[model samples]
Target chain A: MLSQLVFGAELAYGTMLYYLVLFLVLVLLIKVFAWKPINKMLNERTQQIVSDIDSAKQKHQEADSLAKQRQDELNKSHDEASTIITNAKQAGQKQQEQIVSDAQSDAQTIKDNAHKSIEQERQDVLANTKNDVANLSIEIASKIIQKELKANDQKALIDSYIEGLGKQNESR
Target chain B: MNDKISTFFLGGLTFNIGNMVAATVAAAIVLVIVVWLSRNLQVRPTSKKQAVLESIIDFSNTTTRGSMSDSDAASFKLYGFVLFVLIFVSNQLGLMLQVDVNGVTYVKSPTADPMFTMTLALFTIALSHYAGVKKLGFGGYFKNTYLEPFVFWFPLALFEEFSNFLTLGLRLFGVIYAGEILLKLVGGLAFSNGIVTIIGLAPIELIWQAFSIFLGAIQAYVFVTLTSVYINGKISAE
Candidate 1:
């Protein structure tokens, strides 16, 4: 209940100037209050979104390259393992062939030696049999000559003794 | 109250006129709203208050940029923003508020004053002239704006300046003043102790008040849009 102050409705130059000045002040104040801060915030938001997209792209590319590196490493190890296995297999094959060839050569040498010893033993046995035959012949001839003293009478007695000795020797 | 105007005299050659309290109150209300909305503005702008302020600033920027040259967009936006708030708030002052202190009734739009609207129009023209001068040099601006398109058209161009002032100020004053008077008459009907008050006045007042809001916004937009157009005319050689 304090409305005793009455304002005249006349158009005053001072009042017009007052309003213009007021408008000028209001314009300046609005720039401070809403315009500057709002624009700044909007610019910040735009920059933030752009930077976020940038960082996300960077991270995605990094992940892609890392995955490729991992795949490459896996492939390399896989190839290395297969190569090592192949090399080991080839070495094992060579060792096995060498061992088998050496054993075959040793077996062949032993077989040849046994064959030469058998041939020598057979030749020696034949030579000894011929000598034994010659010795027997000489002993028979000497016995006949020594017994033939009287031609007719001694001939029948020597023949009978020689035949009896031959019979005894054959039985023994 | 034959005329509901309160006049205050200071000391010498200056005096306050045409609802100083109402104008001050309108300005203060806008100031408070602007400050309150500006508080805690965020990059994301979650609050409706912040959203409202952001939209206003954005609209002003876009409108200024669209209507005027790229050079004047920044400075004119400040002028446009302030004018919009002053006119819009003052235009909508009498819708739902009644500030009755003692005997005097303080109701009506501050923009209903011809002096106030004319003052803004004068500023718009002055700023545009200054912009033209700054762009083309004083001699070039004078020649281009007044002396071009034949030598006799200089008087016509001078008359055009007066007309710009007249049209811009009068249009705003006419629309807002009529709206305020209509609201006053309708408001009187509602308070009158009669069956007609209940049956006729209240409903019509409600509908008219609702429509007034839209009218007030349109008037404010028109004022700013015309200001931009006038400024563009003065600055551009065409």
Candidate 2:
């Protein structure tokens, strides 16, 4: 067998041609049927994966920005709410001060009016008492003088007597 | 030692019928497997078959890319894949079954024959030169292939090309042929004396067969790798 392998081995043109034709045909068929479609599919899958990853990243960034925007709005509204509450509290304080001041002034005015009216009533009562005393004195004097004297003489006497009584009362 | 190959003469030219038949069988097997595996392929692989096919493609792509630029790798990846599949199937075929009828071995590994391997090597070398010439003009291709680094390296480079051609084919032919020879020798022991010899040599035959299968796979991978390397050497400036 070894001698045959060494001595009998020779190149054959027909076999070479046959193999060449077969190989070329095989390559052609594989290129058309297998390699083209398979390579295309692989490339498409790679591109799809890349694009999918890109879109996912874009969505993540969008979600992040949206969350940030919502957070900012929440912070802003929180600030506005606090400011409104402070304003309402301040307004209520002012209203309370205004109401207290108004009530105080009204009480002062009513007290002053009450004092003036009491003083006026006291003056009216004193004047009426003085008029009544004067009338009573005059009536008493007329009753006493009527029983003691004639007409012209009684008038002169009574005046002199009254005058004498006023001088005597003043000296006493 | 008395093995014979079937042959015929047509128009005063000798044709090796056994090698042709074996090569055709190997080619058919490869085609069927490739076609079946590649059918119904999806972007997202659903079946283990698809995964296996994708990995095989990926492996070929990576092997080619390892020796060439991306653009070159892309152009040649399918060639690399086809070469690997064909040679691998051819290498393992003899391990599965070797048929002999009336002192003539009709079926065996096609790669075991020098003619077939040399033919494949010639094809690869021719393709590399074609690619080199296409990428670089003829003058540039000659200059790059024959004269590079220094003018003094020309003789060495020329010798290297001849040796490369010889070695590429001979290496595959040697390993596969040696493995088959050893397998046959061990198998001969099983039928040599009696059942005692058969039972005793069964383990050795099995081991050798297993080793031959491994060697076949390795040779196939080596052939593809070297092919890309040689092609890359031709096409690329560096």
**Fnat of candidates, each listed:** 0.62, 0.64
Q: What is the C-alpha RMSD of each candidate to the true structure, in Å?
A: 6.8, 6.5
In Å, residue A129's CA in model 2 sits off its true spot by: 3.0
Clashes of 1: 7
For candidate 1, list the clashing residue pairs, or say none. Answer: A6-B6, A7-B5, A7-B6, A7-B7, A8-B5, A8-B6, A8-B7
lDDT tens string, model 2, A25-139? 7788888878887988889999999999999999999999999999999999999999999999999999999999999999998988898888888887677657655764676
DockQ, all models = 0.38, 0.47
Clashing pairs in 2: none
Once superposed on the true structure, which residue ranges of model 2 sit more than 4 Å away at CA? A1-8, A137-172
Question: Which whole-number lDDT from 0 to 100 does residue B67 have in model 2?
Answer: 54
Clashes of each: 7, 0
**Model 1 stretches astray by more than 4 angstroms:** A1-9, A71-75, A99-172, B10-18, B69-72, B100-103, B147-151
Q: Provide TM-scores for the models.
A: 0.78, 0.87
